[model samples]
Target: MRRSPFTTLGGSGFDGSQDAEARLRWFEHVMRRDMDAPVRRLSRMVSGEVEDVIACDVVNPDHIDVEFDSIGGLESIKQALYELVILPMRRPELFSHGKLLGPQKGVLLYGPPGTGKTMLAKAIAKESGAVFINVRISNLMSKWFGDAQKLVAAVFSLAHKLQPAIIFIDEVDSFLGQRKTSDHEALTNMKTEFMALWDGFTTDQNARVMVLAATNRPSELDEAILRRLPQAFEIGFPDRKERAEILKVILSGEKVEDNIDYDRIASLCDGYTGSDLFELCKKAAYFPIRDLLNDEKSGKPSKEPRPLSESDLEKVIATSKKTQVAANEYNSLRSQLVGLSRQTETDDYPVQAAISELSKLVVSQILNLQAENQDS
Candidate 1:
């Protein structure tokens, strides 16, 4: 008589070794068959699913309008995204000499934390009216090995179906980083397979998929993945002028004193990332409100809502500036990028290098800028 599955899986009957062997084999099969299959494709039908369902939570599809809320300080990136990708995408007929529209050259956005990389992406999608799919690795990354790559492939397949789609993969270095194909190598192979699929999508004429990846740790990404993305932009921290603009946006409609020196406030926030600026501004706004409320007693105060004083605002700006660590850390990041940026092979190398060098100089000049801000 043949042994039943009960006996095969039973620890007592198999002496543990046999059961272990069976379990390992079963795991291998499950991982190979199910995990390696297209998880993304199984859900979507002949039509397509909703794009916003996968978009980043912070980025809303409805707010895809320029409400004077433009991204601060990265004019060049904005222009490039518009000129190279947006215009071409909108009017493919102009570039009919077979030069190919944006869907071909994927974009890479790299910079320090809180530097508006994600914001910039949303702005692009808004400006272009493109379907934005925010690819989250953690969401697709299954407990079973090699599942994530299948999901990635499915995402591209979906992107093809949804033409003029912007696939924004944030912190992309995690999946496309240097492959570790040694012992725990399943994920590496999966990523490679996904990459191949991404490459294959280049040919699908109907697939107007524009890939945008962002990472703070650009050095960690594999060269193969980097090369695939020809249009790369660095989303560095806001400079003095940008910090001021960012503050203006964040502090909008707030009761800032008329005499409150915004130029000084912007100058002092040297090295602050875009997120940092927001944080600083938020902090500045919060304290005054708190004070106004706390000062109120049983009797109504002289002012129903206390008008924020210049001194109050100055104090807030000073405290907020102290909180920003980006100014101090910018130089180190700049050094590391300059070293790696040399590998970026393109005809615009000289221009890019010059711009990068100038940006680095600006970082140091921030203190002087800050000083002038103080004197003003």
Candidate 2:
């Protein structure tokens, strides 16, 4: 008595009359029925209105190439992520005993720019084996009045359907900044709806969805948003040893001279971020090529560029100057953070810790600047 799936497509299926898109949709609908329960659940969760938008942000674990080991430093942060986020999703049974042991609903990774926050998020997506929703502000915004809220609602709904999902938002402070009276009503509603859904997911102990956000400006986040993100990790700049390690990672597999002293390079490139170090390496690598081009321009015989040497790196480092934070700029940021820390009513441990770290970094930079000035 059962009818064929092809028959349900109306008329003769695969007759070439239907458009390619329509036929593909029909085929997908038919194939989804036989998929595993989780896939079926995910399919059912995406409503027609938000399906296209949500689908664009869904990142498959296999496609993500980043891994924890690939990141040069931040061992502590990696371990914390494993304990708080990865372990729970990988083995839920261990956390099922009580609500206290359950994974955090939201986590915030905050620190200076170029501190590998985005890289860490990618590593989590790859290592956790969870569905990663790389949310972007553009993806949630809509020109229509009510559509924006619906998009925000759909994000959580889709995330719930895909349990063990990580909804990562890079530069989260921009999207969920401090609520202000001058803000547009639509933007305000979107933030409120986002928080409502976030809280809703927290009540479901069995739900494995997590909101993983990274921000350079933690103080700009709203109070309620901060409350939701209880587990905050500061991805500060790498120390001397870490900088050496980062250098090794950056120069790995490259043609380099045996006399290249990474320790000397690390010591010389003080206060350079991982990104800045990478840029330094890139410029050093170009030294050999620049020579080769010069040789070609003249009547000299063409030859392969020599391997990168310590002098090459040192030359680039000598020319490259790290941008120092201006006194006024530093003071403005420090005052804002000092004000934020003075709020005695709220438990602002994260903000306080960030301020402490910022002070150390600034002091170090000032000393380095003074030393450079004396040398000059």
lDDT top scorer:
2
1-376 per-residue lDDT for model 1 (tens digits): 4221111123112332343355444434433454312212322324222221221111223345442256656666677788877766666666445535425558898988788888888777766656566776665656777666656666776666545667788898887888764624667766778778878887655456778899999999889988888888888777788887877676667766667666687787677777776766665566666766777754547444455554654565564544245455575667666766666675596778686887688666765576567545
The alpha-carbon root-mean-square deviation between model 2 and the true structure, to one decimal in Å, is 11.4
lDDT of 2 by residue, 258-312 (tens): 8778888899978787888888899899989989999999978999898999998
- Each candidate structure's TM-score, on Cα atoms with residue i matched to residue i, is 0.67, 0.76
lDDT of 2: 0.79
Which whole-number lDDT from 0 to 100 does residue 203 have in model 2? 89
Clashes of each: 1, 0
- Tell me the spans in candidate 1 whose CA falls farther than 4 Å from its real position: 1-60, 63-68, 100-104, 144-146, 302-304, 307-310, 321-376
Model 2 clash pairs are: none
RMSD of 1: 14.7
